[model samples]
Target: MELQQMRYVVAVAETANFTRAAERCHVVQSALSHQIARLERELGARLFDRTSRRVHLTPAGEAFLPAARQALEAAERARAEVAAAAGEIRGRLAIGAIPTVSSVDLPRLLVNYRTRYPRVHISLRSAISEEMIEQVKEGTLDVAVLGLPPAGRVVGLRGHELARGGLVAIVAPGHRLADAGEVALAELADEEFVDFPTGTGARVQSDDAFEAAGVRREVAFEVNAIEFMTRFVRHGLGVGMVPTAFADELAGVRVLRITDATARVEVLVWSRSRPSPPAAALLELFDIDPESYS
Candidate 1:
């Protein structure tokens, strides 16, 4: 019946193991078990089926789980609201992004944040979209700036689009497609491609295009950085995608427009789970229109 009991039940349902749930709740297993037993007795129902090898939620547990989760979430939201009203927004905020995020103007954003919340610490890291999403889910990252695939599924995270534009093909000036202003997606199907690994935003855009056109290109090289990909394209290692601005910076390359590829704008993603005080305060700076997401 208590909030602590609700936490224990939810953790157990998620982990499917009493010991792991106890660990997650930062409580001894016996105490968690005792609370659950008391709750079951109060409700006059068995919440779980604990057999020889594994534990499974019983029918009653399944029905009660959603209500329990909602109650916990409501409680947390109340706490956050209280903290926000008191201006208690000071803590570390971990952020992750891919190399393509250079366009995000992070310096300006950080400066603004520092001016408002001088006590809050911020850390940024470069990672692929998948790794960033995982870190956010694990509570290691407060935010992630990524170029997810067009309409790609992002669960348990709220995202706000930063910028949206088409992706372009970059090639050495001497390449056959250099003089072309634009080309179909299938035209480069046979070319060797030097691109970011699978989880990157650029890779997602490229993969989605190829899959839609039913064309497959050979990825000759998978580079970890956008700078490396740009270098590889200049050396004729293969054609690759580059942002229009980035293409201009890379110089010497033919930045041909892509006709069939979809360019999903980069997005700032954060967990829907309760954020720390600093994370919540920083999120406010994004000026997000929650209704747009609705």
Candidate 2:
């Protein structure tokens, strides 16, 4: 049967009244009845039992209604998919981002994207790099904004480098490090350090930073949330290392520059191979000047 027939059938099934369903479907009552009758005839079945005062589904109609509803939904979804592919870019885009990007970049990017494409529905997920990659591969995430290099080996995806920013040390205001303009990596050898748990994107960056400085870290506490780690640093729990942007925003902690060696963390935008047009459209908004990162 035609998609319109399916729509008419579903409307009638929901309202269980001819005039009400007709009004809801924005069709004249007589036209709605004719379409339903045409659908029933095409299917070679009596779909409804109607009297002057009441209308109800017959056994065949009861069986047909759900299938009809499903068909209509599928048709609508197919239409939307085609529309999006045609550069309409007016559908749901699922975005997964690591904690650091979620703090600032994502909000700004989403705001800009919404202003440009108001009809598009955007869903945001906060995840670490590895998890975000997994979601993209499994088709759960349309795109991901994560720290570079990817946590896992690159497989079945493409990555776009967005920006790069330096790491900063977060220390308690009263701590010795608070007085320093910049501290050497060797100075952290004896200090208690707060950092992300192993296997996290931040942890990978933290490890690389120390390795680049030819120093081994002395991590006293390993936690997931940067905010929590900063808190730990603020109360003299340990010195914390995080993105300069992250450290700069914390009120109770002072950020100290790391000296001797320059370190950088790259922000990356990634998506699975052959992403949907909606995903591609949303990804465009994430583009920023690489120079802006530092």
Candidate 3:
């Protein structure tokens, strides 16, 4: 019924302990319990099954939980919108980034943003591209810089390309493939490959290319970081693919072009819904006329 009751219910559902939920809500146990009891009585359904040991959400509670959280999020968003409209740019900006976007100039970008908006607090979190995209969709992350879909489209987001480059094959300096100027992806089908882990940006790009070419890669090493992939390839462990920008920097490896089918596009993605002021400002600063996808 009341927003406070909704908060209490959600807290109890998450912690699974009334005492802890009451503590989190910053109210006495009896008051929180009484309000929840009143809410259940009005709704005519038991939200939780209380045994002395552990609290469990009843079927009704499970059904109510998501909506309660949505309502809470909506209220918070409304408050942020009001503040932003009133020219208050002094709010926290939670940014998500992928560690391997070497050419993005993240340090410079953050520095400039901080210089321009000194009152705004900035927090950057490193995550795989896929995780960042999902968190942005969920409104947990204000914006993300990620290796994005080739066409630059996300279901619930508005984004634009930050940087675009083709992928290159890397091999040990003296390896057989090192001198090969450019090779087709199909040529590497029979070769042992070092690749990114599943659900990652590079992996997704590689997988789509392989599937489109009607071939499969024998991924002998599945590592998460591009640094590790290049290192392994340099040791003659396996051949690997990486963004062209970073391929030349690997000292022990010789870079070869993956002809036709290997490219990466880094996109700046944000929720399509009304974004907070700081997020909008960053997008405006980055989305230039030449490379804007949205």
| Best prediction by TM-score | 3
Q: Which run of 10 residues does model 1 get worst, by summed lDDT? A: 285-294
lDDT of 3 at 147: 86
Better of 1 and 2 by lDDT: 1
- Give the poorly placed runs of model 2, Cα more than 4 Å off: 1-77, 85-87, 102-104, 149-153, 260-262, 287-294
TM-score of each: 0.67, 0.66, 0.70
> lDDT, candidate 3, residue 258?
78
Task: Provide the clashing-pair count of each candidate structure.
Answer: 0, 0, 0
How does each model score on lDDT? 0.82, 0.74, 0.83
Error of 1 at 129 (Å): 0.8
lDDT of 3 by residue, 170-210 (tens): 88887877889888888888889999888788788888877
Q: Which candidate is the best by lDDT?
A: 3
- For residues 222-288, could you state the per-residue lDDT of candidate 2 as single tens digits? 8878888877988999988877767647889888887653444454544534455566666555553
Candidate 3 lowest-lDDT run of ten: 285-294
Over the full model, what C-alpha lDDT does candidate 2 score relative to the true structure?
A: 0.74
